[model samples]
Target: MKNVIITGTSRGIGFEMVKLFSEAGHNVLALSRNSKPVSDLKLKNVTALEFDIANEPEVVNLSAYLQKAMKTVDVLINNAGFLVNKPFAEITAEEFKRSYGVNVFGVASLIKTALPFMKTDGHVVNISSMGGIQGSVKFPGLSAYSSSKGAVITLTELLAEEYKETGPSFNVLALGSVQTEMLEEAFPGFKAPLSATEMAEYILDFSLSGNKFYNGKILQVSSTTP
Candidate 1:
């Protein structure tokens, strides 16, 4: 029904999103550092692309590929992220850079490249964390990850305003901990209240129909109120 591009589709939320959108009959361009997972899906409407989001050359290649494959994009979901949990003192500079490289720069690059192919009134959803929301629950050892998500929220707001007179709408979804591999890694032994599939379903519906009512807003998706 629509042309959708989702980044970080190797697994977890991104993977579920690829299944959700493609099964709904949308043309889905799924990006991941490794294409094997999506490749195995064998979905008729899904195209798997292999590339690291943190790499500029790969992103450029994605842009060029999209230019040739799609005339217009209805949705762009920036779902790729890097997380490193450690005490603030133990957080290395390299770690921070790595986190920002994927969480921040990767997101910016995709938006920059995808906008040209986006149809008027298209939706751009940047996946963020609840920790990124001001006054939200704080956790130790999430310095880099939280900070990067915060930056994503800011960028979404600014981009939305910058493109107000134009076409596409930009929004950030600051989600609570979801039950996924990323959550397991970030908080070992702890169980998250929401599942990735649930989140993906909501995101698919919002991107396809509900996004027009909102622009430049950061909605915190969580069972527990922040």
Candidate 2:
């Protein structure tokens, strides 16, 4: 019965999450640059919107949509991410900017927009990567991607602290490799331990109830090392 907002819903985890939430009888606003996939699903409770989080104007439009279609958001999952797999020495400034634009800045802007529409019981979940965790296992050619995700983890903590009294808990999840198209695109032939649906189901449950016990924390949901 809750209104949920999910970004990066064109495919993979975000796509599965939309279906899961809708099947669970919740309303979902699925946002992705390419909305056709979700739109084609035609779920009664899911509304797919063509969204580019990297675009500030689109974020403002999202705010307007929230005001018109939903009075409040029960869950805001910042699942949209941009990854640039390039060696640090060779990574360009534009590449870094594109990475941060979607992974960090977009998450921040979306969270800020959602804050006014979020209640005390709402949750804001920022999706990060195990590579983003300090002291965790690192991967080569992920300087821009991993660093931006790291920034999101820190940003989540600060936001949680700033709005502790007002409520709407903020948390970040540092996930291990999942068998997603993003993974395949980034690293061909690599197989992850979990599937997109499995990971999506875990995240769906956490988004609904994790705020009750945790906030301003980074939960590494990985079978991998620290």
Candidate No. with top lDDT: 2
Tens-digit per-residue lDDT, 131-208, candidate 1: 898889888899999999999999999999999888699988998888899889887898877889999998888877
Lowest summed lDDT over 10 consecutive residues: which window, candidate 1? 203-212
Clashes of 2: 0
- Where in model 1 is the C-alpha error above 4 Å? none
lDDT of each prediction vs. the true structure?
0.90, 0.94
List clashing residue pairs in candidate 1. Answer: none
lDDT of 2 by residue, 68-129 (tens): 99989999999999977778999999999999999999999999999999999999999999
What's the C-alpha lDDT at position 27 in model 2? 94
Cα distance off (Å), candidate 2, residue 26: 0.3
